[model samples]
Target: MKIERYLTNKMLLLTSIFAPINLAAQERPNIIYILTDQQTATAMSCVGNTDIHTPNIDRLAQSGILFKNAYCAAPLSGPSRAAMFTGHFSHEIGMPSNGIPMPEDLRGLSLGMLMKNAGYDCVYGGKWHVHTPSIPNQTFGFRKLYEHNDSGLAEACSAYLDNNPHFPFFLVASFDNPHNICEFARQQNLPFAEIPMADLADCPGLPLNYERNPYDADVICYEKSLNYSAYPTSHYTADDWRRYRNAYFRLVEHVDMEIGKIVDAIDRNNLWENSVIIFTSDHGDGVGAHHWNQKSALYEEVVNVPLIIVLPDKKHAGAELPQLVNNGVDFFASVCQWGGVDLPDGLCGVSYASLAESGDPGRTHQAYIVTETLFDKGGNTRGWMLRTQRYKYILYDKGRYREQLFDMCRDRGEMRNLAVEHKYQETLNKHRKLLYEWMNYHHVKQIRTEVHLIPGF
Candidate 1:
C-alpha cells in the first residue's frame, strides 16, 4: 500500500511538472504577419481616404486594433525591414540604408530564428529586403513559400493554409505592388498621362500639400531631388500630378485584391478563430505629398505606416488606437508575446499585445524618432525626426536650414515651419532636448565617412 501511494504521488508530481507546458502549447495562437511595401496609413477607405478603396485591409482594421499614429523606424526598405525583424533600429544593426546587408554577427536576432527556437513553424514568402544573401523566402530559418511576386505570394500562402498545419505556425506574406508605382514615376509611364484633357475627369486630383512648402528645410529639398527623384516632380503640372495619383491608387487596389485572396483562404480554412493577424507596411510612398515621389524622407507620407493587429478572438475589434507605435521595432516583441515565447533582452520595442487584447491604454512612448543615415550628393548626411502627439521636429547633420518644426495639431499638412517662431521656441527646445536624449540613449554617433549609395537607387 505504501509503494502504491509513492507511485501515485510520483505520477501526480510528473503531471504537475508538465501541465503548464501543455497549456502553453494549447493556448499559443498561430500568427500571420502580412507586410506590404511602401504603403501609407491613409491608403485605406476606413482611414478616411476617399481616393482609394482597400476593403480587405479595411476588414482587418474593422476586426482588429488600428494604430492611427504608427511610424516606421526608418523610411527606407532594407533598414526598415531589418528593424522589424530584429526589434532594433537600423543603425543598431549596422543597416542604415536600403541595400546594406545585416551584420553577420546579429543574424540570429531575426524573428524567424527566435520563433523557430520557441517551437513555432516559421514560414516566409515574397520580398525579404533584410540584405541577407540567401533568397528572402529561404533565409532566417523560415521555410520558403513563394519567391517570385505578389500574386505567387498570395497563392502560396492560401495553399499553405489549406494544408492544415497542425503546429502553431508563424507565417509572413510580404507583397510588392504599389511599390511598382515607383517604376511608373521613373519611366513617366502614367497610363493616363497622355489622355486628352477632356477625358481627365477620371484622374485623381492633386494632394492638398502638392505645392512644395516655402519654409521647408534644405535637407529635405535636396534629398527629395536625389536618389529616387523621378522626372523633376517640381515640373509636373496639375494634370500630370493627377495622373500620378491615379496610377498610385490603381496599384493599391491591385494589392488589395491580392490581400482578399489570402483573407478568403483564412476564412475557408476556419483559421480565423484560432489565429492572430498583423498587417503593416515597411514604410510608405510619397504619393505626391510635398512634391515627393518615393521614400527616404521625413514627410508624413513616407514615415507614417498602417499597423493593424487582430487577436485570436478579435479582441478590441474595431478599436482605433492613437498611441504612437514604432511598427518596425514593436512587431518582433508583439509576436513573441502572442506566441508564448520569451522576448529577448535589450530589444528596443515594447509589446503591444496587452493593448490589442484588452484596449488597455497602458504606457506609451512620449516621443518616437525616425532616423535616416544614408548617402547623398553632399556625402553621408544623417537626419533625425522626432514626433510627439502635437508637434514634429526634424534636424539634419548637414544642411543650410537644418531644422524644421511644425505644430501637428494645427498643420497636419506640415505646410508651415515653426522652428524660427519665437512664440513656439519653448516647444522647439523641448523636442530638441528629447531628440538629444534619445540619441544619447541609443549611443548614436555621426557617420562622417560617405556610404556607398545603394546600386540602382
Candidate 2:
C-alpha cells in the first residue's frame, strides 16, 4: 500500500510541474507592432547599408528574428498596408490605390478586429491612411485610435503603454517622420521643402542604371513632368544627390529616437516579459538608390523592405531568416497564428509563426510578387511587375506590348535589359509565364498598361 501511495504522489508532482508549461504555451502575449513609413531594407544597418547608422533598429534585430529577404506585397503605402491589415491583396478587397476603403463587409473581419474579439485591447497610433469616410465613423474597428496626429507617435504609444498598466494589449505604433515631404506630401500632409542637395553629401553613388541611356526616352518622359521620376533628376549636380541622402538619413534617425521611447515604455511597464514585438515598414523609398525618389518600380530599391519580430521569453532571439517572405501576403497570417487567434477565412498571406519559433526558417520556393501602378498616378493603368529571386519582368502595354526583363544575378544593379536580347529569349519566356500565372491567380486585369516611364537609359 505504501508503494502505491508513493507512486501516486510522484505522478501528482509531475502533473503540477507540467501544468504551467501547458498554460504558458496557451497564454497569449501582448503584441506591439511598430510600422515605419517608406523605409527601405537598405536603410537599416542590419540589412548591410553601412552608410546609415540605425543603432536602435539594429538592437531590435539583435534581440529578435531578422528577415533578410522580406518584401512588400506592393511597393507603395496604401495598398501594402491594406494588405497587411486585411491579409488580402489590394484587388481582393477592392483597394487598388491610396484613399480607397476596404468595405466593412469585405473586411470579413481583420486581425485587429479579431484581437478585439479575443478580448485584447487594440490601439492604433499614427498614420492610419486607410480611407473609411465613405462608410462613416465606423471606429475603423479599433478599440482606440490615436492617428499619430503629430510627430510624437512614439510618445503616444508610450502614453498608451503607461495607461494599460498590466493589461495584455496589441498596439500598432505607426510613425510618419521618415515618410517626409518628398514621397507623398499630401498623404501625411508633410509640407514640401526642396532642401538643396548641396547641403548634403557630395558624390553619393547613384543607381547603376543612372547614366542616360538610349532606351530611356519612354520612361524619362513619363516621370520628368510627373514629379515621380524613375531616377533622381540628373540635373541636380552630384552634390544635390548628397543633400537628398543626408535629409533621408536625418529622417530615419528621428524615427529611431521615437522608437526608443516605445521600447522604454515597455521596459518601464515591465511588459517586456509578456510582450511580442514586431518592427517593419509598409514599403521602401528609392532614397538615392537607382536615382529614384519614391516607389512604383520593380527594382530592389523600392520592393525590398526590412522585417523584424521578437517574441517574449527570448523565443527565437538573435536569429536571421534569409527566406524570401512576401510581407503583404504572409504577415497577418503569422500575426494571427502567434496571437492564438483563428485566422480570418479567405486570407491570402501565409503564416511564418511556426518557423519563427523554430529559429531557422531555412528557405522556401521562389514566390512571385506583383505590383500595379496607375498611369500618370491616377489614370486607368500604368504597369505591372513580377519579381523573383533572379529575374524581374515588367509589362507596360498601354497601346502595344512593352516588356522588360533583367537578370538580377548578373545585373543586381539592373543596368542590362535581357528582355529584347535574342540569346536570353528562353529565360524571358519562363519568367513571363510565371508572372502571367500569378497575375491570373490574383485576378490582375489582363488589360496591358503603358510604359509611361523608364529610368535606366
Locate the minimum summed-lDDT window of 10 residues in model 1.
448-457
lDDT at 186, model 1? 71
lDDT of 1 by residue, 96-181 (tens): 87668777666686788888888889988888877742246445869878773675679899999999885789998988777877
Candidate 1 residue runs with Cα over 4 Å from true position: 1-26, 132-138, 188-199, 228-232, 361-379, 447-457
Give candidate 2 misplaced runs (Cα > 4 Å): 1-26, 132-138, 165-167, 181-209, 212-217, 220-224, 227-234, 375-380, 399-401, 448-457
lDDT, residue 428, candidate 2: 80
The Cα local distance difference test for each model comes to 0.74, 0.66
Model 1 residue 225 lDDT score:
56
Worst 10 residues of 2 by lDDT: 14-23
Among all candidates shown, the one with the greatest TM-score: 1
